[model samples]
Target: MGNDGQSVGDRRGGLAYYELEFADDGAVARDTGLRAAVTAGQVDDVFVFCHGWNNGADSARRLYTTMVDLLADGLARHTPDKGARTAVTGVFWPSLLFPEDDPTTGRPASAPRPTGGELAAGLEPAFPGNKDNLARIGVLLDDKGGSDRLAEFHERAKKLLTTPNLDAGEDSGERAAAELPTETVITYYSGWSRVDGQAAPGLADPVEGLWEGAREVLRTLSYYEMKNRAGQVGRGGLGPFLSTLATPDGCRPREHLLGHSFGARLVAYALSGLADGLVDGASPVKSLFLIQGAFSHFSFNDVLPFDPGRGGALSCYRNRVDGPLLSTFSAHDRAAGWWYPLASMLKRQDASSQADLLYRWGAMGADGYQVDTASRVRLAEEGFPYGFTTGGFYRLDANSVISTLQSPFSGAHSDICHPEVAWAAMAAADLAGEHQRPAR
Candidate 1:
């Protein structure tokens, strides 16, 4: 994990590739050599990519290499002149992997619950300083304690996940969950599992396997923690590093940002960290592409439909994108379609249909961008007529291409290494370069 910034020295294709690493605290590692390579003027275009959860350096490298190889091939075939002028930098960070469930049965293939000690050890890195609470949770899980123990676990989990002195009004579900009784939370989980078809018939009562529920509670907390960390690393680490890439008066390479799943959130938050004066003028990044994003679809909405007075966290930063901001969504992405909303919404009070609740808490990968300023487009082959322009927000319907049922837990969420997806990214970069500002 500490060697995140080191290069593997193997470029699968003929493309110039590099690896830039960031600590969980958003701190850039020293001497990655990416900036040096880009500033050498050999590269005119830079595609910076970030991977989502569960990816170690090895997996992240494969994703970057696969996508970049496609991009390089596309450029060689379509725009041969620019083929040698492009480079790629894969961003590496520490993200934890969740257990996978069988697609057919909707349960883990092996044991349903890890030993209490195993659970604690697996979670300790993500929630440091919570050793005492985690130990208590382990003991309770081993004992299969009752409602009182469940309530205690919630308190401890909340303490580990919640940030103090922060604004809590943004996510109504999270706020409501904070005030919910332990029993209600369990009921919500039970109902969610039933809808997901994970609750098998004739199993012990929902309350009997309280330890299973406890494990779920911990997973939910971990989700929120990773969400927060993605933003932290983006703003504190990647964003600042990007700013340093261009001098106020010097010409810089045309940069494009691409992120998948939680990595999408990380790159979007990077917009907020750019120097105020650079967004419109000296900003190095030109376009942004989110492939199967895991964050809220309403993240860039100026005014949320549910709450008239509130807006998304990145609402004001929309103009920060000097060119197009594109996001891909697919119905096959169950991580965003199902678990994302289920874990996100701890409680719901409306009397409306289940679709309404899902819509309110839906993810960008599942439902696309919900902002009124965004337009929808179909994900097409390499030479399809996209007609995309600068300064536009596009929700690309990738259902046709990203529809493979890769896994039960993360249905097609990671099925984005296709050539068509790479073409979409390259298309946006082409548009941005066409409208690029003249060098000062």
Candidate 2:
């Protein structure tokens, strides 16, 4: 019941809850007590939940609490005994919120552009080390500068959110974006504004929309930063912590990881870190349920469906989960459906068609796991059977329940606090428990 990094004994909805705070660089906060509590065998099962970008510490807590409460309710109705020893670990990390479209119409808001101070204030926290760069960009925005100044602003913004060499995945689109000419980048940004959340025609003149285009470019850069940070935190902090839990004298509870948006990328990268020899023993992760994952759909694929010569970044880490690896996708999630693809690509003509290009750079949340090995299933109600008996990849079409239009920019992206989703997580955990039990 304490503040983010200070809380370790919080309890909610008849279940023990712990906050595990991590820095952007993937360092765990001191004295969080998650490790000690788990090692003490306080719980037999741990549901580790991580939030994606656009969430503060408080919002993340609310999300975890709400989802965990739903899970608790499901358990009470279905399997009462299992709820007694279960615990929830909510992961809090640094992420920033992007400007959103009108919730009612799903179109760009008509609000005036943010002033220099406003821009700086809004972005300073997310780019902590680049305060000066953010301030400069803000000044440039306010000045309505010429092409030279616009180029400078873009350079500063890009540097502010540049991906670290260690955390850079196999994202050719991202690389292409970084290498694009300033004018082409502006053109892409202008095109994004017209196509963001509406079926609008492309912009008539990219230069005319330079100011808005610059802001859009900034948002894209922030997205890239958040993506990189997710991987960094997962690999450096969460993965090492999980390794500790897997130690001989450690707790070794059946761990079920549930992450939403970029948080899904976090958990997936945690497995990557573990697979890269961070831990010598077998993985402690029993089940992984990625809700509206914000990473590449081909993350678990051995080779890209369109390009056989290349494979996903996390392909080798797919089997790290001892039980099932499930991901949810919804067509209504505009953040994943629209913005994700736009931010991912620089070239508008990369593929044979627009659909092909989107598929090439699509997010897991919008497109699901794009691999031949993944089995597709519907997101069922509480009492329905999931039949997740064995360990493998499964993509759940959550459009039935995750179809609510919460916001224009991120339609139903954050509408995952539903009972059906909770049931799915619990079902996955139950299957993982079955796998962990000694066989006759």
Give each model's whole-structure lDDT. 0.73, 0.75
Where is model 2 more than 4 Å wrong at Cα?
2-8, 99-113, 165-172, 194-208, 246-251, 275-281, 348-350, 431-440
Count of backbone collisions within predicted model 2: 0
- TM-score to true structure, per model: 0.87, 0.89
Could you give the C-alpha RMSD of every candidate to the true structure, in order shown? 3.9, 3.6
lDDT of each residue in 18-101, candidate 2, tens digit only: 878888888877435566666666667888999987636777878888988888788778777777678888888887776443
The sequence of per-residue lDDT tens digits that candidate 1 reaches over residues 51-160 is 98862567777788889889888887777777666778889876765433323324444545456766766677666788888888778767767778888877876776
- Global fold similarity of model 2 (TM-score): 0.89
Q: What is the lDDT of residue 168 in candidate 1?
A: 25
